[model samples]
Target: MATIFQKCKAKGDPCRRSRCGHSWTVRYREPGGRSGSQREKNFPTKREAQDYGIKAENDKREGKYLDPSAGKILVRDYAREWLSRRSIKETTRKNYKNFFENHLIPRLGSKMLCNVMSSDIEKMCQGMCEAGLSRRTVYQSNMVPLRSLFRSAVAEKRISESPVALASLPRLKTKRVDDKSLPGGEAVGAIASAMRGDLAVSVWLMAGCGLRIGEVLALRDTDIVEGAMRLRRQFVRVKRDGVWKAELSPLKAREEGEWRDVPVPSLVEHALRHHLRNHGVGADGYILHAHHGGHVLDSNYRTEFRSAVIKAGFAGESWTAHTLRHFFASSAIAGGLSLLEVSRWLGHATIQITADIYGHLTPDAGARMRSVMDGVLATTNVSRDDS
Candidate 1:
């Protein structure tokens, strides 16, 4: 139970102007705490204190009582604990830490979790936008972590509710995939032809098989199974002992032992065979490796890819190594493959993602429906004449 009393420096003294001030204070033990442990909060008026006392009692009876002091934790401190408690991939954790240090901490670190309001988050998002960050960066990259943190705080009872739940977020502007956005077959061939003999096969693996850059580097000779490439892992950059190194990690969004098999076209297979015959396999049967015969880093491949792109007369073009993946997706959609199949091959989290980007490329559904209806009506007319 809560009780209201006038605050005074002297014990049992009447309310008066003193060092502690003549404000009304509500004193009560937490709903679930042991006896003799009390919590107090000051209010400017006796009625305010009494109202707070009644609300506390009501909350306690309803089992929704929250200790007001628990939310006093600084966001920086709480974020540290929250990061430590999460079970996430190392690369993902690194990204989170970097984002927190660079973006979130600088803006909201000093504020207590309970003190952070939706307007504060909105202001932070607006600041990110004003700094020239892209809409996708502001909404997906920047807001996701903060929103998750506040949601976790609410779940843990550290705060009454998440301030980010109502915060304004940037609108994500999506670009549709089409022949114009994706490179054509000749463009891919030209890029491949311009690459070095040893690394040229990387282009085909991406363009023909829809492999991510990391997946391309992680490919191994032994992973070829029954005329298909079994994607077991990906080469990812991880920070180990204060140094970032290229390491083989599990496939993104997949379990440790889970693997997907992508059929290798004749072009990709021939390229792989030729690459193995000349460059040979690196340590642990990896098809591609750095100069030191270890796993290839992103910089190593990016530099070569850029040089190849320029040599292929696309230096001023926006085409990237990942564009080959888009090229593959575009080709798959054009070849009458279902969105679900394309999504699986592209390793997308869901078919909806594939549809969102490439659904416009689907064959004219209205025309196909019209053709079917025409055939149906013709058959119905013939049956009526026979009757």
Candidate 2:
């Protein structure tokens, strides 16, 4: 039984109990809140009791301390919360969710949010690379999400610092070069030859006017007036419950940037009139559908374009649906249109994208410029000779 005592001395102090065998004494309060008696303990030596008392006091302090529960939170729980707080479009959110579900959670869900160290994350990334995932994918899987999680943890006071601060990962490289443009004349011919339904007319607009796939699909019959096609909305496919389907959403262009009017070529206008006359518009009055009814999903056009490419023998090399847009831009540059004009036609937010993709055409433009300069020089020399 433990005793509560006060004014006691440990053994080996000069004060000794001559008659009793007890070697040491202690001064302590009783365990209860009441007044207590002083007590002394027998010790083989003074050092023993002194050491025991010091250890007991240390243990008491430790027992009274409370550690935080922040380290106990799991990585998976915080990840879900983080995703919910992000302000991204529905399609973008779906993509992030897929990456988290398929790649992130399965690997690191069991980790404690606060206790996840940099070494653990680095090992996970190395493992992913060894497993044949690309460097870009590994960064997406481990680096991006871990950084976001640790940042949140710091904000919530769950972690003191992000462990991945010094980590390095590979940068994403562009998958392929951007030179797959076809000639505009060939594009028009392909559209004319491929006419079987209203789809053929939409193909003509896309190839001739350089419209995006989404923009082309979202057109309404009423959008065309006086031989001009109006661009307003863009259709995008989003994943819902693991299935991807088209949704006719508003244009993703910036504010006050929804619509553009493109003049239709004579042949394209004839085709459009033919499609509208024979098929008639749908209840929604979209122009580029079977019998001019129902909205055409972008996927439908991609499939038809690929089929057309194969039929026209353009499939052997690098022609794709997007080749038509590139073809339009390249042709415009080749036809003496300024980069600024081409940029506006393509609805680019900036002219740099237009110049980067089509800047190679400047060489052709420069050749013609040099010819005109030489001709002017020759005329000046001939006038001087006549004088």
Candidate 3:
């Protein structure tokens, strides 16, 4: 950090009918170092110049000074640089690009980063929602990029403060769209029963063990060891040249590529064995195979699942393959499984993630409260004595 210097320019003589003009200039180095552009500001009086020079010097010493012109740089230039520096997955990169192009760049690309305020951001978010954008898209695509951009600007001393932290953000509901539409325990069994062959086995795995569809598709005969099945990776689809292609990747866990075992239920084991004995599997030994023994895509499962629900006497129920996963975790919690245990079985990144989804579905909250209240009243003996 360097100190600011005050330079005063004084007029030596006045014209016959005019007064002499005088001004003060405060000169300072740009925030980074001496290599930066030369900076100077002028004031009408020496006292004002000295005050600002002192403040600038102190701010520079404390690392709070930002160049007034630094923020004039367009957001597009900084955002593009920010995106280029990040190492991310292909699908994630594609999504971020869409967010930048579709949501943010259209509205804020030309604007300078420092000129934007939290109110502008709040209005942008409200406008997106008002324009019928989903809450998920608003936060993930628009708000996240905005936050990251301003955060970087502050770190680089391009701006003195972040607009994101300046105010409260608009409400964005975090619940999944299908949270209300997931099937109950009875519906789970019926759908599993309606499926046949590989679909049947896959549904049972989702319903009984809560394995994700990607993990189910990636399950191999080689993964089974000592009556436990390992989930180390998932089948992901990445786009190339505007076409999605299947690729195997690590699970989206706290530790990337995390592997965990799920204890096999007798029913799931029976269903898996039945499919294995009759149909075998793809060359990869995948338990769930697409037509012609390839990876089973979501498109393949959705068509079959739609028919299965109708066939299972659940014609009016709206259910997807993911619904089975939800039902299994909720049912497990209702049936006396601890959240910590169920979280492990479902391979959740944290117990909090498991509780966030199925926490309200747990039956013990009301039941245990009832038991505790009843016991407390019984021990008090107040009801009998008053009677």
Candidate 4:
């Protein structure tokens, strides 16, 4: 049986020549006729000494217990290790790293992983909000990394529980803007009028076929066959350490039910043919290329496209590259295509997204309930004349 004083001695050595001089001691007896005795130098309070001793004894009994030798590990250290194992795209990883380095680390880096409580996380979020970050951006740029860090700690048994659950942060409020769709007929004509060279073909593909910017840049001459384009690859620019690098990768879910061939409109096909004939395809067979004969980067088109938008007086108005995709989906739906078909064309994961984003565009959507009610009344024949 261990006494409180004996437990204190088991903790470790205490400073010698102290005022109270309450030195707790421990003795270890070996089976092989060997005995060892150790004494803590001195403690001011017997209670402090006893508490330390009890913890040490408990740790000794439980092999799983480990005393924090260098204090608790900081949140920042765990975050780095967590990110190292994440299987995300290069761009996503870079963004996560940036969020940690720029926002999370500077504020909570020194906080002990085990000691961080829900209050600390809530305060951090409030600070970010006060700093003028939008609620959505704050969640993504700060809370995301913190949540991941706490989750990792829980999984590694570094801490028994995650504080993220206690934080109970609310989702950011978002207004679904009616911003999806191509520019109006006048704006489209203006863009077409202003665009020359390779830019013209790219814009045409986006507006006419609903191709994403990445898909447009990834298009190759060989991809166009028999008035159809095979969708396979997408060109994306990922920021690595503050510099953007262009990469050509296969489209996500290109196999196992996500891939499809899209029919090219006659005008788009003609424009593609003209661009290929005049500029000639790259050695890599890409239809779009930089002036120096490499893949056309998003930045390159961004500058040119923004300039064209402004010159056409659509700048600071209802026009963006993605709007062209919206335009394609809207046009397809209005032209008597099913929602599922439109979703497939846009490479969306589900038709629900297609319906949600563009459901308001249906001319009869608002009157659907009224139409149903009218049909019910007509079938019952309880009209005013009958009454």
Candidate 5:
């Protein structure tokens, strides 16, 4: 229950005994408070205070009560606290920190968490778009953290609900036509040839073995078996003591000590041998290492990749390093590998994810199935005499 009253400020002076402000205060028992503790808020008018009291009681009964005082914290403060408490992967945590500090906090940091509304979220997204961020980036990378933050705030009772759930974000645009096409062998060869001899093997590993950039960067000779390579770790940039450094982390979407064995095709094996004979390995045994020491930094690798792309006459194209992974997937599908086989080879969390991304590559699947059925039926020899 809530009670509204005018404060009796009579302890100061005789003149103040009969004089009081027009403000009214609503005193109410706090929801989920220990020992039946009370909280209060001042209103400019009696009706407003009465309305607030009624709403507070109703909200408490409905289990939607939000402490007004708790919501006063700024977004920047709460986001830092939220980030510190998150139990996500180190790579993902680093990425989230980048997004929060550079994007989310810059836009919404000064605003109070409770005062933020759905419009603010929409506006923030619009601003990102206007500032040259792609629609996919704004929708996926940017919104994910914001949505998670507000959702956490709601769960923690800092806000009544998440504004992100109410905001109207547009659907992401479909993949561009160019994104559907993977590089041919010639293009791959050209790009690799344009790269320095020591770094050329990365192109082959990614294109021939479906290895991710991080996985390739972290590969070692010890992990290579008789016919396959074990993927157990990756090199990713992580922030430690306010400085960024490349660190080895567990494989994505897999538990610690869990590893997958991907077959090293002849092309990849030959390239790996050539790289080893020429450049040797780092102190940590990483195949790809810096000229001075340590594993190759991700930024330096991408920069070299871009330079190679330009030198190979692939400038102004959408051929990012991940494009090699797509080429590998397409080649595997074309070579009659089942979706499940390709999914496992590509280290996907699920076969459906592989199918969703590369399903179109199997356009001749129905024809091949028909041909197999025809062959099986032809061998059956269904003569009338046999019947």
Candidate 6:
């Protein structure tokens, strides 16, 4: 147990003021029995000092004790150590570096780790919005890192609690993402016909199979089955030491290596067969080619796709590579596939995610029920007038 004492001044001759203000001091032996007493002084009241000492002792007993001095480390230095200890994906690391350099360090880096509070983070979020950052960017790039670092700090015993634990976060912006611009089945035919060679097959796969552009670019000869394709990997462009290059990475999910056999539609199969017959497999074993050894490069693919869109009489940016994937998803839903089944086919991490993005496409049975009940339960009488 800790004890508090009134530290009265010694018998001084000059300018004495009420026993030198009667400073209260709480003193206790270190809980681990390895050192002398830990003194907490300068408290104005004995109750306050006692409260402090009791909380400290309780924390020590619970194995949650943090040295008060340790939290005095600057946020910037601690953040560096925190980042060094993390092994994250290239894209994730890129975002972390961007947030650390632009948002976190400039604002909170000089402050002590203990001084960062929930309200301060809220203000930062509001300030970022006022400074013209999008709501999603403010929440994702600012508030997220602040909350995350504080969590790490608490786990490392540098601070007692995460400040943002109770903070009301900004709402992440989500527009209704159902693919409406796609003009049904004819849209895919028009777009794919405008492109030449493997570029044509790429379009068919993306539109017909719900394949990501990166995944389409990364496909190999071994991935093709009779009427299905094994989606095992994706081609990603990542920056290291300020240089960017392509890398083959596993599919994105909780289980990174998960591969799904997506059924290839007849049109997609025809395109793939045509390409394989014309180009065969490249020296590097890519099933398609762009007339430049092996698979098509990302920049070249985008360039040709833009030209194709222009030729097909559509705005270059309106129907993107991802738009085709959305087209595939919407078409599948319209063809009577269940939401859960579509989510698995889409390779989403959760059904909730698939629902959030594509749930608008599903018809509302509850609305139909409300309509039927309204007619059956109507109180107003309908008159048959014969004048």
Q: List the residue pairs that clash in candidate 4.
A: 7-53, 8-53, 181-326, 181-327, 182-327
RMSD of each: 5.2, 13.9, 5.0, 8.5, 7.3, 6.0
> Which candidate gets the maximum lDDT versus the true structure?
5
lDDT of 3 by residue, 207-293 (tens): 888888778888887887666788888887887788777778777663455788888888778888898898888878887887688
| Highest TM-score against the true fold, candidate | 6
lDDT by residue (tens digit), candidate 4, 1-387 = 234443433446744444445555433221222342332323456676566666655655654333342228887887897899987666667778988887778888899888888887788787888888888788655666667777767666577567877886887543333644357757876876676566778888888888988888888888888988888888778766777888876565453223567888999998888888899887688888877778888887877777788888877765777777887778777776777777787877666667777765655555878898888887675548655
How would the candidate models be sorted by lDDT, starting from the highest?
5, 1, 6, 3, 4, 2
Quote each prediction's TM-score.
Answer: 0.80, 0.59, 0.79, 0.67, 0.70, 0.82
Clashing pairs in 1: none
Model 5 C-alpha lDDT per residue in residues 1-387, reported as the tens digit of each score: 799976654224323533355577899987765565688899888899999999999998998888778889999999999999987788788788898898888999999999999999999999988999988899977777788999999988998889999999997644522334667999999999999777899999999989989999999989998879999998888778998888888887787788998998888888888999999998989898888857888888999998999999989776888899988988888788888999898899888678777776765778878998998898687667745
- Residues 1-387 of candidate 1: C-alpha lDDT, one tens digit per residue: 798887565367555555455788898887665763688899988889999999988887887777777899998999988999888778888889987887788999999988999999898888888888876887877666787899998887878778888776556745677677677889899999999878899999999999999999989999986679999899898778887788878887787878888998988888888999999988877888876788788777888999999999988888889999989988888788889888898888778778888888877678889998998887564445555
Model 3's C-alpha root-mean-square deviation from the true structure amounts to 5.0
Better of 3 and 6 by TM-score: 6
Please report the TM-score between candidate 1 and the true structure.
Answer: 0.80
Number of backbone clashes in candidate 5: 0
Between the candidate structures 2 and 4, which one is better when assessed by lDDT? 4
Instruction: List, residue by residue over 11-86, the lDDT tens digit for candidate 6.
Output: 3544356556677787676556657447565688767888988887797788877777779999889988888777
After superposition, the stretches of candidate 2 with alpha carbons farther than 4 Å from their true spots are: 1-74, 110-126, 134-166, 175-184, 225-230, 238-244, 252-271, 333-387
5 versus 6: better TM-score goes to: 6
TM-score of 5: 0.70
lDDT of each: 0.85, 0.67, 0.76, 0.72, 0.86, 0.77
